[model samples]
Target: MIFAAILAGGVGNRMGEVDKPKQFLTLGDKPILIQTVEKFYLNSRIDEVIVLCHKYWLNHTKDLIEDYIPNAENIVVVEGGELRNDTIMNAVKYIEDNHELSEDDIIITHDSVRPFVTHRIIMENIEKTQEVGACDTVIPATDTIVVCHDGNIISDIPNRNYMYQGQTPQSFKILKLKECFNKLSDEDKRSLSDAAKIFVLNGEEVAIVKGEVFNIKITYPYDLKVANTIIDDAKLNISDAETGEYKVNLYDFGEE
Candidate 1:
């Protein structure tokens, strides 16, 4: 059985929303986090989904179920911590505390604001990671990349040849994840963006899985506009098909 841990712990400081976190922010009508969870639940490979939400927003997240965003049966809602790594660690503890998951049971770690994650991506993540230790999704960088410093040209233009932009829906074997997280040190607690980074730092190599371009993360206000355009285009495409099924164009919109 595969269990999903949808990481909804971000405060979205970059977007600067004082009212609520970006995950709880409304995109059209549904909450961003709810849309993310729905993607996992819709996939047949996913058996259960556990949401790591902020404690203050617990009641609000619960209300979403009545509106058909999250399925309450296979869903397990838990409180999140301040830091992203803290939240992830807490969620892991929640799993370890209550039940003992076997080695074969895979766990997918994904962000909440990234609601555009597709069923195909979800399936591929599981497929790539189930056999090998772990798998991460990334898209090739579109523009020429460079590293800069203090308005000064610190580094020259980087060859975008093999560089790719990294994103979430990173999946790991339950046993491997448990092994990695189990051995995390104090410095590991300090450095925390990618889950696979911990393993990589400890000398474990990870496999890369190609990701869809439309699977974007909603960070700033403009991103919402882009997402709106993508959503509308998908709506029109499905409407034109004449079939009842809604088939969305994955990664057709903006330049990645």
Candidate 2:
């Protein structure tokens, strides 16, 4: 089974003076979390959608889903963990407890704030993870990457050609991810920046899936403004096909 884990564990500390967490904040018409969920829910390739939400907002998350999504039996809201990776583990644990586990099963983890994620990115993540054991979505770095060991000065400057900014749906073979995660020492686990780092530290190969620049995470107030503009443009680009399915040309927002 292919599961898409939508991580909504953040409390929106950076988004100062908000009534609720940033995920619950309205993006265009619906909450950012709901829009993110719908992206996966609408895709026929994904079998299940698991929402890992912070404990404090769990009920609110459930209520929002119930109100917005019709017949959302496949989508489940579970309590997130203290850490980002731990929240992902919670999703894995939920899957193991409720459903049959298999070695080949895939879990695609994504940030709930990134509502602009295109269907193409989701499909590529699944396809690449099936081919390789793991994959991370990223885009080429447009600026020179400066490595600063200390806040005072830059230790080294890396070539921009080799540098890429990381993004999610970081996907992995479910069993393989669990095995790699288990091998990590407690200290190493605590220091992890993201799940793909586990594979890197374990000498495992992780393939790359190209990500869109418009696949931005809503972290601050300014981002919400940018997201609204993107939504307006997306509406302009949307059109109906002969089969009666609505196709959104997110590429019009510089996705390619």
Candidate 3:
């Protein structure tokens, strides 16, 4: 059984004045968290989705899920811990305490702010992870990168050939990620971004699935505008079926 854990328990500091965290903020009509959750909820491959949110937002989130995504199954809203890792730890604890999850039970641990993730991206990531060990979408650097020192001259421009910007829908096999998480040191535990990083630090081969540019994380207030435009563009480009139902798989374009 495939499962997804969305880490939606953040109080946005960067997105000042938008105090309720970026996930709860409105992107036009739909909440950013709802949009993020719906992408995976609509997918047949995802069996259950456990939303990790702050203790304060837990009940509200549950109500929002009911109102927004009525068709989803096994949707659980749990109170997250103070720290990010602590929040994830709570999710891990829940999985261990409840379900008999297998190594192949795919866990797509995603950020709640990145509402631009498409159905194709989810399908592609899961498919690739099934083939290889683990995979994540990363973008190559476009501008010059610098290695800086403490207010002094440091190394000159280095090779951009291998540099990449890591994006989300960062997926893993539940058992593998659990094993990696178990081995993390306190220092590494505090510094890690996603499950992929934990695997990399353990010398495991983590594959890359190229991410689309529109799948941007909403941090600042300006990001919402970009996401709105992307959603609008997506609707415009995609067409309806013969029965007048909108084809959700835009990436399945012309694929016989």
TM for every model, in the order presented, reads: 0.88, 0.94, 0.87
The global Cα lDDT (0 to 1) of model 3 is: 0.79
Query: What's each prediction's clash count?
Result: 1, 0, 0
TM-score of 1: 0.88
Which stretches in model 2 have alpha-carbon errors above 4 Å?
A: 239-256
> What C-alpha root-mean-square deviation, in Å, does candidate 3 show against the real structure?
3.5
Better of 1 and 3 by lDDT: 3
The C-alpha lDDT values of all candidates are 0.77, 0.91, 0.79
Residue-wise lDDT of candidate 2 within 1-256, one digit each (tens)?
9999999999999999988999999988999999899999989989999999988899999999999996799999999999999999999999999989888899999999998888889889999999998999999999888899879899999888999999999999998999999999999999999999989989999999999888999999999999999898676556433335645454345434
In model 1, where do residues sit more than 4 Å from their true spots?
Answer: 69-71, 149-151, 243-256
Q: Give per-residue lDDT, candidate 2, residue 197.
A: 96
Report the error of model 1 at residue 221, Å.
Answer: 0.8
Top lDDT: which candidate number?
2
Alpha carbon lDDT at 36, candidate 2: 96
Candidate 3 per-residue lDDT, tens place, 1-256, comes to: 6777788998888888855778998885799999888877878898878899988888889999999988556788988887766776677778878888776777777888987776777787898778766788888988778887765887677889978888887777777777887898889988987668888988877888777777789998788878777666555556444346755534332222
Weakest lDDT window of 10 consecutive positions for candidate 3: 247-256
Runs of candidate 3 exceeding 4 Å displacement: 236-256
